[model samples]
Target: MKIASLLLFFVLGAVALPAAAQSVAEQQDAIVIENLRSAGSDITKPHSIDFFLYFPRKGQAKAAATEILELGYTVVELEKSPERSEWSVHATRTLVPELETMKASTRELEKLATEHGGAYDGWGTSIVK
Candidate 1:
C-alpha cells in the first residue's frame, strides 16, 4: 500500500509541475481572453492580435520583423523608442483568440525574439464587436 501511494504521489507531482510552470504571459493570455468574452467579444471568431518584440539594436528588430512576416504576421510598425534606446517591432496576426492558441503563439514568438536577441513583450487585441 505504501509503495502504491508513493507511486501515485510521484505521478501527480510530474503531471502538476508542467501546469505550474506556465509563464506569466501565458496566464495573462487566459485572463485577457476571459475579459474579452465578458465584454461580448466572440473569442471563436478571428481577431487581430498584436504582438510586441523589443531588441537592443535596430538591425535585430528588423531581422525579427522579417522572420515574423515570413511566419504570416503582418509587420505593423518598426520603430525606436523615443525615451529609451531599445527598438521595437509590432506584428499582428488575425486568429481566433482561444487561450491555448494564444499561449502557443506567445511561446513561439518568445522563442523567436530570444533567438534574435530580443524579448517578446506580450500581446493585445481590441474587443471584437
Candidate 2:
C-alpha cells in the first residue's frame, strides 16, 4: 500500500509538470522583442568602469578577481571587505568606441564568473569625477 501511494504521487507530479512547462512556454512566447539600438553608430562611451562584487568568502572573491585580471582587464583598485568574504574591484577597459560592443564584452565577463560557479553582483561604467 505504501509503495502504491508513492507511485501514485510520482505519477501525479509527472502529469502536473508538463502542464506547468507548457504554461511557461506560452508566457514566454507572449513576450515582445525590442531592439536596443536602431541607429548606425553612437559616439558616446564611458572611458572606464567600476565593478563591485560580493561573494561568500574572500578566497572565492580573490579567485574571481584573479580571473578578471587574467582576461586582460587592468585592475585599477581592489579592496576586500573587513570580514574577508567580499571584494570590490574597480577596473578599466579601453573604450571600444561602440557601446554595443562594450555591453557584449561585459556579458562575456558575466558568463565567465558563472562558469567558475560564482555569482556576479553588478557593475557600472561612466565618466569618473
Off by over 4 Å in 1: 1-8
Q: List the lowest-lDDT window of 10 residues for candidate 1.
A: 18-27
Task: List, in order, the clash count of every candidate structure.
Answer: 0, 0
Output the lDDT of residue 17, model 2. 88
The local lDDT score (0 to 100) that residue 53 gets in candidate 2 is 53
Writing each residue's lDDT as its tens digit, candidate 2 over 37-59 gives: 22322235344545555556556
Q: Residues 1-129, candidate 1: write the lDDT tens digits.
A: 999999999999999897789987888888889999999998989999999889999999999999999999999999997766899899999999998899999998998999999988899899887
- Candidate with top lDDT is 1
Residue 20 CA error for candidate 1 (Å)?
3.3
Sum up the clashes in candidate 2.
0
